[model samples]
Target: MTTGNIKPTKEKKSRKSKPVVNEKSPLLPTKHEEDAAGFDEFNGASFSGAVFNLSTTIVGAGIMALPATMKVLGLIPGIALIIFTAFLTDASIELLLRFSRSSKSVSYGGLMGDTFGKYGRMLLQICVLVNNVGVLIVYMIIIGDVLSGTTSSGIHHPGVLEGWFGVHWWNGRTSILLITTLAVFAPLASLKRIDSLKFTSALSVALAVVFLVITVGITVFKLFSGTVLMPRLFPDVHDLASFFKLFTVVPVLVTAYICHYNVHSIDNELEDNTQIKAVVRTSLTLCSSVYVMTSLFGFLLFGDGTLDDVLSNFDSNLGIPFGSMLNDAVRISYAAHLMLVFPIVFYPLRLNLDGLLFPSARPLTSDNARFALLSTSLIGLIFLGANFIPSIWDAFQFTGATAAVCIGFIFPAAVTLRLVNLISNLICHQLSFCHLKESRFQFSLK
Candidate 1:
């Protein structure tokens, strides 16, 4: 070896020692293998889980008030508007997929940041914050109503609250709110993953199915038995202004069907982002079918002039167990559901809040911190809107108009266009680089 090459000398080591990491960082899963698994396992959800998530998020507390929305728009046009909104919603989803791919980041906030920069992110975060807050307020109001024995406004028959068990707490809406808040927030505070809410999500879907069966079955039975006659066939459309007035229903329908935020969660859980397209398409199609069927059955059974929140259409003492049973079932389902759903809404809320005030403490782990934040937010919402329940629906409409339309429709398209643009730029850059190399070679040879 010495004959062929020179030997190397030993090197001296430095006196300094490397510093050791005192606090170990949490372990992150190493492999991407799990993501490639089945759609059912990606989000730690089954097929039923997907269905339940879709149904619960889409239905929410809004369904009870749908009759009032339909009443404003009339039957045919109301149905048409529902269809139109569905189309808008579908288009938005398709667009979001493209944007997600181009952005190369998971979740809606990331995609938004890629497209519109900081302002875009801020705007989207604000919209999400408002929507979540709106929903929380709505939930509180609902719990208050149920606890205080108040019927949905039009469902306000005189003796309806008299027979309810909790009617004794008639003036105790504040105590009711506090109790419900604690119940709803406690589990949410402990939840590690929002997606883990699959159980309650499934329960929500079951409740919807149960309600649907009862509502449709009872309506059909009533129709066949001739106990309840159908209402007017078609309302007279005097002018275009009357037709334009139908736009009033747009807010409620938009709010009811809004599930765009759910898409972000679906993507996060998905093994392959491509599956998101499938899930969203499937979910939207299912939701639209449900809405159309439910709306039609609702209008035909209760007639065109039904009030917002369909519960109002029936007589207070409507000797039907279907109504009462459905009410109790839904109450249970949603009550359980709020336990799960609250975290989904709260995660984004906390994210936004962290970004706004406590920039350094983004990933908050302290349970006390979470509890305090939630309590403050909930209390603030109640204080602002406690006396304004009558106008909550109106607020919902405005929130839906901005958040639902943009998040559901516009953002998706913008995202898709951004992805397509990225792909085109990448291709052009490669082609230009190749052409420049060729031109240089020819010039040198010449």
Candidate 2:
């Protein structure tokens, strides 16, 4: 045969496999460069461990204000909203995971970048900074309230330290918060990874349980002793302004369940990454149970006397055995639990702040100077905010209405709306997954 008669073969180009993964595959993993194997020393976190961390994130500072919301919405509406928020949170997180998997995006900021642009991601970082800072400030304020006491409505609710040792310069609000900042918060926040706080998260959850058990005990004792009466099951609305006050309770409820910011971080660390859904369901179920019990019984115990910080209501004499002791126990245990929860919140705050300031820089844990500067600067700012802020309700409302709402609901909805056509079939096929669209729709109408 002549050489010219042989057809030229088109060579198959050898292509490299990109790191991006398809959702249909089993792993469904979208990891950051720093998270790749041999990059970080730590391995992935266990399912139980991830649940504890996420639960701590959800159950922080917000729980204190839930009873106040009950005062506004009443028990029936309050409990209903709480459960609804849990289901909604589960739905939102599911949407987040689905979008993340489709785009092969790892972090929340990264997901935003994929959906909107760099500016969108930057906006998310700013919102996170505002929300988490507001949250941590509330934590510090509650700690100050519990350990050093808060003065509200012409009544002085004495802190545990004051009751135990009387007020000293060292035991004053400023001193107690400073000492806690240096001793408890500083050490924990300085840690590098979310998974590292697993033990502390477990301890924090247990301490919350301690508070719940004590509240239930006191409520039951008073109920059985015929010393207590059920509070209003539905909110009382008399006038136009009174009706609007019901809307004010929305932020408190939103803040109570605003754990979306930490979802990606927790999912990234899970050893069995697909179990992220289960971890979320488990965490929300546990947290919603805790929130309901706390709201119902805390309101029952206090009734019309419930203060913005329910812990403040605990300062008064309960008609029970060793009432002061029980009061002290509840406040002290909760304060300590907040100390543990501080780092879980602080971890994401620091990460986002660093992302905002140093987008092109290396990983946060890799740079000692950047990590220290951000950590101290944030703690100092929050400490100042706690001291200056007059009310926890004000902080919760401000953060929840603005940053928390955006972080929790708006951005995710925007992301989904931007690309709804792409994955319409994927979402429509799974009836269980339809909750996100339904929940978000209900949320907007609300």
Q: Write the per-residue lDDT of candidate 1 for residues 1-446, one digit (tens) a residue.
A: 25657677545211122111100000110112211221222213344455556555676655655655556655677677777877887777667656555544445665676666657766776776677677666655554544354445444522223335434554366665566566666555455444566676666566656656666877787678776655544444589987776666666777777776666664554334445566766777776776777776776667654545454344343345566655555344444444455555555555555444453332344445754675466446644564467544766777777876676666667767666788899999999999999999999999
Most accurate candidate by lDDT: 2
Q: Alpha carbon lDDT of residue 346, candidate 2?
A: 90
Per-residue C-alpha lDDT of model 2 across residues 309-423, encoded as one tens digit per residue: 9998888789798999999999989999999999999988887887677766666667789889999999999999999998899999999999988888888888899879656
Candidate 2 — what's its lDDT?
0.84
Question: Mind sharing the TM-score for model 2?
Answer: 0.87
lDDT of 1 at 311: 45
Which numbered prediction scores highest in TM-score against the true structure?
A: 2
The runs of at least 3 residues in candidate 2 whose Cα sits more than 4 Å from the true structure, single-residue gaps closed, are 1-38, 422-446
**What is the C-alpha local distance difference test score of each model?**
0.57, 0.84
**Model 1, CA-based lDDT:** 0.57
